[model samples]
Target: MQEAEDLFPAPAPAPAPAPAPTPARDHSAAGHRARLRERLLTGGPDALADYELLEFLLFAGSSRADTKPAAKALIARFGSFAAVLEANPLAVQEVKGVGEAGAAALKSVSLAARRMAKGKVKGQPVLASWQALLDYLAIDMANLNRERVRVLYLNTQNRLILDEIVHDGTIDEGAIYPREVIHKALDIGASALLLVHNHPSGSPEPSRADIAITKKIMEAGRNLGITVHDHVIIGADGHVSLRAKGLI
Candidate 1:
């Protein structure tokens, strides 16, 4: 019986293996977003770079997505934060990941900026806050791809009455008639007017055509006892006042 038991000895128990180490959690993206938020709260918008500011804006629209790439791409495509905000919604949507919602988000900023600027100039003498008026024009028209002619009608006090777009796409005599401007001024009871247009070429230098048209409009307004305050040309680089240059 002892010999038979020895032949069928129990097998040794299998050795236990050591447990594998758990991988570290990757929180890098979350950590970055937190840091950016902290910096913005502490330092205000001036502390963040353009792309960083754009990233923050994108985060509001897409909380879970990584927004750095989209922000950088927008800035690169549109040239600046202001430009991106002012861009057409369709143009903005051309960028990957910037769908309708993202484009709308950017457009909302532009609309807000315009409203704020208009508030500063409306019901106040535009010349009294010259810088603010210029800023409003820059924000509204500087980045436009086509030429636009706007008329700023003013009351006797030089306070803005009506801001109207007279012509868009091109500013030829056929499109911008002196008679039409005079009729509008009369219709609005504007005692004075400011003629404004944008040059998409980034240069505010007035063409001969621009000078000639301004003279025509000025003459028309003068005959009716309406003051032609200035003919301001907006460009991407900066703005130019025909009055300042003695062109008027």
Candidate 2:
């Protein structure tokens, strides 16, 4: 008593027509990335141009997207790889195609370079390696768009025990508390302190405010048995030492 339509069942709906095979995934960028990696590994420091180096860093962020455009955009926007790295993470992301990941990658390199340069001077007598210390400071503070104060605390042996960034300020002005500067030295048992800061104006010359603060810190440290060895003002072209100029 089954109906004829029920008996036939429409021939299984013609097997639902097998879904067309998905097109093969594109591997062109992957191939290029592999070649670039090989070249980087084999070639020396000159292996890649600035943009290419940026591409290498961006690859860490994006797996499938082509990084070349991002790299080029960053270089064009920031002017150089070092400038790109020095930029604030937020600023770096202003470029098209670069997100937080890309910005972080660039920052990691910047931090690594700073640590490496610092290692050359750390644990060594900072005064004896005066040029090395200068090099480290310049690398760290030269490109800053605002003022930042770093205090290098040295034990009685004149070896660096601590390097701390104490304060950051606007493009044209900054402040550091004399009591706090001395308190940190006393707390760390540092016999001497080397103060460092950068000028956003590209000049290492000390302002009246800079001299006033340096003297105040020195006076505060004098009573506490901590010596203010120098206050170095870092700039793009050169550095000035308060002690060298007989200001402190």
Each candidate structure's TM-score, on Cα atoms with residue i matched to residue i, is 0.85, 0.76
lDDT of 2 by residue, 145-222 (tens): 899998999998899999999988889767788988899898989999999999978899999999999999999898
After superposing candidate 1 on the true structure, give the runs of residues whose Cα lies further than 4 Å from its correct spot.
Answer: 1-27, 170-174
- Per-residue CA lDDT of model 1 for 17-40, tens digit only, reads 889989776577787788788899
**What would the TM-score be for candidate 1 when compared with the true structure?**
0.85
Model 2 local distance difference test score: 0.89
Best by lDDT: 2
Model 1: how far is 83 from its true place, Å? 1.7
Least accurate 10 contiguous residues by lDDT in model 1 = 168-177
TM-score of 2: 0.76
Question: What's the residue-level lDDT of 35 in candidate 2?
Answer: 74
- The model with the greatest TM-score is 1
Lowest lDDT 10-mer window, candidate 2?
8-17
